[model samples]
Target: MKYIKEFEKKMNLGSDNQLANGHVEQASIPKENEGSVQTYVQLLKPERFYMFLEILIYCIVGHFIGYLIAPILKNYFYNNLEWY
Candidate 1:
């Protein structure tokens, strides 16, 4: 029990690095899961929200392109003559 608490405290202290402009580094506090249902949510600060959205859009577009290309290529080969 004692060792676990120390480990957790060290992990929670991860954002204490210094910035070049003398700002204390900080990040979102972790949230706890709801009982039994296994669902939880984090309220993102604005900067984090913007970064999240940017990454989300990139992932969505990348997956969409992959999904579109998969069927088109499959059909192109399936429809082509074996000699070609």
Candidate 2:
């Protein structure tokens, strides 16, 4: 119990009472227009485009790999493996 208390004190877990007593600082709220959807859309416009391009490339590459490997595996299994 003493070790747990010491660990909590080391980790600042016992500061909840201090926080409740107004030692905690609050985050400033953004203005109504600052946090609008239009602002977020503007911020994320390029990122969204890049994300879509990345997903499309990944899907194309995955399909290419699957198609390239499927026939090779099928040929190898049919030619080399014997099922009794």
* Overall lDDT per candidate, in order of appearance: 0.62, 0.70
Model 1: per-residue lDDT, tens digit, 1-84?
677556656655324453434344653333453342323232324677889999999999999999999999989988885963
Best by lDDT: 2
Which residue pairs overlap in candidate 1's backbone? Answer: none
**Which candidate leads the pack in TM-score?**
2
- Which pairs of residues have clashing backbones in candidate 2? none
Off by over 4 Å in 2: 1-44
* Residue-wise C-alpha lDDT for candidate 2, range 5-48, written one tens digit per residue: 77667767554333422343433334776867775654454766
| TM-scores vs. true structure, each candidate | 0.39, 0.43
The per-residue C-alpha lDDT of model 2 at residue 74 equals 96
Name the runs in model 1 displaced over 4 angstroms.
Answer: 1-22, 26-45, 79-84
**True-vs-predicted CA distance for residue 29, candidate 2, Å:** 18
Judged by whole-model lDDT over C-alpha atoms, candidate 2 comes out at 0.70
